[model samples]
Target: MTSSRLDGTSALVTGGGSGIGLACARRLAADGADVMICGRTAERLQAAAKELGCRYVVADVVDEDQVAAAVRATAATSPLRAVIHCAGGTTSVGPIPQLDTAAWRDTLELNATGTMLVLKHSARLMARTGGGAFVAISSIASSNTHRWFGAYGVSKAAVDHLVQLGADELGGAGIRVNGIRPGLVRTELVAGITDPGPVLDDYLACMPLDRVGEPEDIAEAARFLAGPESSWITGQVVNVDGGHHLRRGPDFRAVFEPMFGAEALGGVIPEE
Candidate 1:
């Protein structure tokens, strides 16, 4: 059982339908916060909320109106004390030069812009309610130059800076903003892309902890940042990758090369 550090407070988690978002919601709820989760899918949101004993809101982070409405609805139910921005994903993966412009735009729009919008609206409510904490789900790829993770890494890098800027601007309002850069967590998003066997092995070999991260691992970091434990910590991106960041990331190009062929990878894949 988790401690009730957040009793009588409320938390809003974007992308809470599944994966890291759902984990964060459950952790906050367990800590005695009235949690509300928002996502684009109604069915997933309903199921997640039911399981977490929280509320659900169908809202896409990319949609400004929907995000504002979600915040307003959550605030009406309880004092908004925490906001976890976890709704982001890469639309495509490849080298920057060959990457489609549409994919690049979409990635930034979802990962970076989405975090900004959530932080913007959530901060406003937090300021009115005596302030709170804001946590954004970032990626260790933001710092490393991982092959085939160009757009995703770039977008997360943008999120890292946004968290810093938000922390600086909202400090006067008593609002603390931070980010969690998870390494390789086995979530549905990861499962949809490729088999985890080889990737997990690669990560475990380099990771000091000798294992891949779980959703609950990142959830614990989110819990710390959202709760009073991290009151003095702000504007920082915490790495929760089980020491994977100390070394390089998995070479995704090596995994996809045979399927896509060397010619298809263009300059993205280096000569062996």
Candidate 2:
């Protein structure tokens, strides 16, 4: 399990400053891949690169030029065989009737369009080297319904479909595109929602395993898909959730109601 399955190759890990992104970068580097981590924060990426002993790039995935530059930098020394896009989050949350248009667009730009630009530029470099693997860190919300998570769900759903199309289009170039839908993972991003409370309890109740996931859980899957072990797999969005998808997404009403007003969300979120 610790063998150098990706020796002599290179990997580009986005949002590598922390959480699942950093975990994947560590796993990939430990496996002997020349790794380059990128993110919007210079201070964090600097710290991560120093600790991980991998190169770092300060680039925004939503920016095409920045994304393209990151790819070029990663492949400059070795073939960029693996691109793990773990950079994405949503600021937009509310009922469809009250969804902020600007927030919605921004969420789509960051999650959905950002994914396209990353894949577009990374594929250009990967195709030149005869092909590579692209792993997208998606969410179960993309497939399952999570009421009050308007823009985020829509955007991630787009990402899932985009992966399918990318896999279909890039198969000829020897590239494989896949996605990972993670369940409720313990990370700083979701810290507020998971602070020992009713919201956290609801999430645990929905999960068949009745526990949260770790960054390494998703990282292990990324390592496999990026290597030859999943050589025949492509165009598939694998769920790494703790059986949460089998039931339903957590009720965010307990959390979102306090912000957007219970009456508003109640008007929309169906009661089961």
Candidate 3:
């Protein structure tokens, strides 16, 4: 019989409605895994499921009960072998001092807390099935500081640490936990930016590859960690950033100041 990497196993991808999550789902399904994607938007999930030939659950990761339910639904299909947490984004952008408390809380809740909840429920299910791999979508911003990425950066930093802690805790259970820190990738999130050209230019200037990342770039790394090929790798944060981590990221303050006004940025400027 011809063999595939994830044959006879099922994979779960959060935020699979679009972007990196959807890309990961596609990769996993292509590898012969029965893939299920979950996110808050039912329409997007349905659309993505059809396009990728996978299943989907509409659930909010921040809600523990919903997350648990999503896991249960996935496990009902087959032995869950892989989970990719891609359900997070930054809702706020500005200087640290100017950032609203709600933005900070939302950032942490969605990125950090949501990751923990997914890990918690997915690990439990995996434990019952003799363990699997859990991969969280983090950001290069976690370590690379930029003027307006403070909240987002801090949340991702927490995710990185959580991946390590989870690895340590779940290792004995045969579960491996890891994270992927992606560089600037064009996604719906970035598409929301008022003017992305200058920002894209800034990122390109710093990227050694001279190009921004595609969702597939991160998805491929996620596939490695999720499959048997990386059975020994865990608790690691892989930078699939096209070498952008070696250089500074885009200056959001600079790019948005003209649109939002310098005063809105609270006097923040990129360091020389």
Q: Rank candidates by TM-score, best first.
A: 2, 1, 3
Give all candidates' CA lDDT scores. 0.88, 0.92, 0.89
- Ranking 2 against 3 by lDDT, winner: 2
Model 3: per-residue Cα lDDT over 1-272, one tens digit each = 32447888999999999999999999999989999999999999999999988999989999999999999999887899999999998887766656778988998999999999999999998998899999999999898887766589899999999999999999999999999999978787777442456667677788899776789999999999998888889999999988999988666665667755787577654454
Report the number of the highest-lDDT candidate: 2
Q: Which ten residues in a row have the lowest lDDT in candidate 2?
A: 263-272
| Residue-level lDDT for 154 in candidate 2 | 91
Candidate 2: which stretches are off by over 4 Å?
1-4, 268-272
All candidates in order of lDDT, best leading: 2, 3, 1
Candidate 3, residue 132: CA error in Å? 0.3
Per-prediction CA RMSD (Å): 3.0, 2.9, 3.4
What's the CA error at residue 131 for candidate 2, in Å? Answer: 0.6
Single out the weakest 10-residue window by summed lDDT for candidate 1: 192-201
